[model samples]
Target: MEEGLENFVPLIKRSRGYEELEKDVIDSGICSGCGACAAFCDRVGLTEDGSVPASECNMTLGAVKCNIDGICYDCCPHVSYSWGGLEDEVFGARREDELLGQYLKAFAVRSKDKEVLKNAQDGGAATSLLLAAVNEGFSDAAVVTGRDDSWSVDSTASKDKKEITGGAGTKYARAPGILKLGENLRKIPRLAIVGTGCQIAGTRRLEKKFLSSVPKAELTLIGLFCYENFPYTRLKEIIEDRLGLKMEDVTKTDITKGKLHVWTKDGKKHEKAVKEFADLAPESCVICRDFTATFSDITCGSIGSDEGWTTVIVRSQRGMDLLNAAKEKGYIEISDKVDLEAVKKTGGFKGKKRAKVLSEREKEGKFVPDYS
Candidate 1:
């Protein structure tokens, strides 16, 4: 019996989960379901669905470390500021009308991956810019949106901030992952944040709230051209019940090649041709007045081109310098094209239409609608 007790003690000491949880800090936002151990030398692990098994994570007395540090628990953006915490260092700015004059600052960029272009909700420009910012130390971390594992259908990720690294291209889902900025601002001194029109507007508001204390050097905003985002519940219904695909089987989904393409493991490859899905664009998006992400230092999307590239509009001198430096460093290939004015015109037209519609509505006594 003593021999058996000694053997069990050694077994507990050999736990991988225990070691990682006790030693290594977990970054919930960057977890890709690559199941390694948590800490503690225990066997606690991540599932393919990106969730952790709570049963395996149960802690008991006699354990050297408490189980408060479970990776599964640590990995939740909803819980820990571990993924990306917002600190008091954030400075906010408000510049909605200013966004229009800054419209000319945007431009487009492209890559050959039809997959990358298509998977991106807009042009691949936002992802490229984020990569460039991190590479140049313009920011130590980037905040972008992705699908919430909990809410599979919502367009918003977490309505909180997330720290993303090694840009795997843009996550074109309908969720807001940048909402956590308030919690994470302390850990990250320099941050590059990406958001849609309304979110950026909200970010500007937040910036203003923190402006007195938060330094401008701590934050950079990149706004994506948002047309509309589908609600997650309805989207799930459409994809699963209507299209006959399981949610878990889906590896990726995005608007690409002028269509909404969905890839699933059920041996199904389907698409909503741009014609059909384009009209389904959210009404909130149509009514939104900001088309060029004017509030952002740089605005990126595919409003200008049908082919493979992101249209990046640089509104501030800082934005221009960043792009030029990226070119100098060879992180991006810069080419001056003649059609830039034309692209700006396209964005302007859309912005005008949106503003006109909103004005008409406001005159009739309506508040800015919140669709998400």
Candidate 2:
């Protein structure tokens, strides 16, 4: 090997950049496109198009700018992530429960507002939380997901009740939920990021690293319980081909009780075995180890609660304060009774499954990673 070229390949492999992320994770078909790299880094850009997916980090247009301090590398949760370390760092206490994580309160929660209830999935708890965060001034703008004219989902910084409500329903497709978070950093004093485990993991790293510049103390992170997210086109094929229903005709989608329940415009509900959509799940989701978004101040999902109610896990002091205020202000209601054990049972199963996959990958000598 030539003197100058001898260390080039190894150096590139070792250094962390968008290009590195592209080759190792994205091109390897493991990039979830959670938008953490795009949301926080100035040098990286993410696109949701199929042909030029977020997995494609275009180095021809933008080169590496992270070699100086490795700040961008630090922002990625996948490069190397330790859930237990982060939980202790963020919460200042070790998690006693393995699956459901640390929480001050657990509840089967529902929205008091009829509008949110009508539009949201699972009793509107996540949407209701975003609305309350905005109304209570805990957040000036929120990072949320909404659909376009073509019904494609994307992340946006929502500033008002209308925008928050517009992003209410679950699209059930994987989209970059925090792709544009940095754009609104200066515009909004306090910003709340709502996303799945992958996105929240990346956001948690970014929040911790960029506190001074981004007003770290003012930020709020809320997470969703995600077992698996599906590919859009494959999901459509399953819904339209097997179920014989047009994608547009389906009004809302929810996964509960081992079925994919799709509601339509005619006020009719269609159910399909979730196993039918198994092949449509992304390659990235297969090895992910987190089902509960344990890093966030608050995490909400439907797994642990009764039907039409969201399982709420208030994980931080800030989350507790916000939930209390929201309840007092007539935004959310706590369930009279909750199955606390149910959250643990479901979440533990998901965690165990993920751990097995991660262990298998390690045995196979493949790259085992989390997400950013």
Candidate 3:
């Protein structure tokens, strides 16, 4: 037996393995691909697509059987759980603002660092905040999403300013960022994470489950506004085949004002309606309602801000403190001129869309998470 195998044997027997997760979540097509299930288990890992299982359940390979209360299933954001319960646990009350969820303040912010602004998407607020957190000793590292030359997204744990800056720009494709969290959680005591709604939700679930083992303050969540995410291959196909743009020549991509804009290295821009690629989005996104990353300490997006700024929604007191500290250190500039109604309109649309999707799934006898 391995050094720690005996201790995990008892827990493994009491926990549901990947088989149940496959049937209930993956097979049902509601898995968010957050990688929470595979993050904590050696037997479970994601396939090359960054979603779905890599192999069968190792625990059930022979005569071993898995039981209920598995960590994999329990930590999944797609599994049935009380959204209100999580809200209350995180914010001390259920959200009154159904659209934006719980928030203490909102701002139109931009980064003061020239390099960060140059490399980041929107105003570089997320990158600046992460830099401040690591520089000030609030966090030892940050797990962020970055892309390669071909726009393939992946997650990395950045421990320094240069590493964090490298992960500045956004990639429209989904990457399972929680895998990095699980890998570095034990080694890095203080960590920050930047992710979309589903990824943040999974992190919150992990935090709640391992609260005794890991303190709540150990992890900081900075959420990004995500309406939906596309598989990298499909998105690449759309760019290469449909838009007639080579992935190698594409410099940047942005979604704003209902349009998907792709910029090439030669300064040529290609544009298409955002809705044109709706069919390419993941099936799991249909059931997701977290447009503003409601569970995060701070949420950043381009929805309610100007062309060169990011809309910042501060949710927790810790988030506020961090933002203030960053501002004091001259990492970013904040303005109280956000278009709240604009943010609300986008979030409300997502919530309504999710409700309709869930209703349809319920009627079709498909598995749906307990939103109530």
Candidate closest to the true structure, highest lDDT: 3
Instruction: At residue 117, give the lDDT of candidate 3.
Output: 93
Tell me the lDDT of model 2 at 56. Answer: 35
Per-prediction TM-score, please?
A: 0.57, 0.85, 0.91
lDDT of 3 by residue, 87-121 (tens): 88888868878668899999999999999999989
Candidate 2, residues 256-304: lDDT per residue as tens digits? 7668888888999999987777676675676666677878899988877
Error of 2 at 46 (Å): 2.6
Model 1, position 228, has a per-residue lDDT of 49
Local error of candidate 1 at residue 35 (angstroms): 30
Q: lDDT for model 3, on a 0 to 1 scale?
A: 0.80
Q: Where does model 2 exceed 4 Å of error?
A: 1-15, 49-72, 349-356, 370-372
Task: State each model's CA lDDT, in order.
Answer: 0.48, 0.71, 0.80
Best first by TM-score, ranked:
3, 2, 1
Worst 10 residues of 3 by lDDT: 1-10
Evaluated at residue 315, the lDDT of candidate 1 is 63
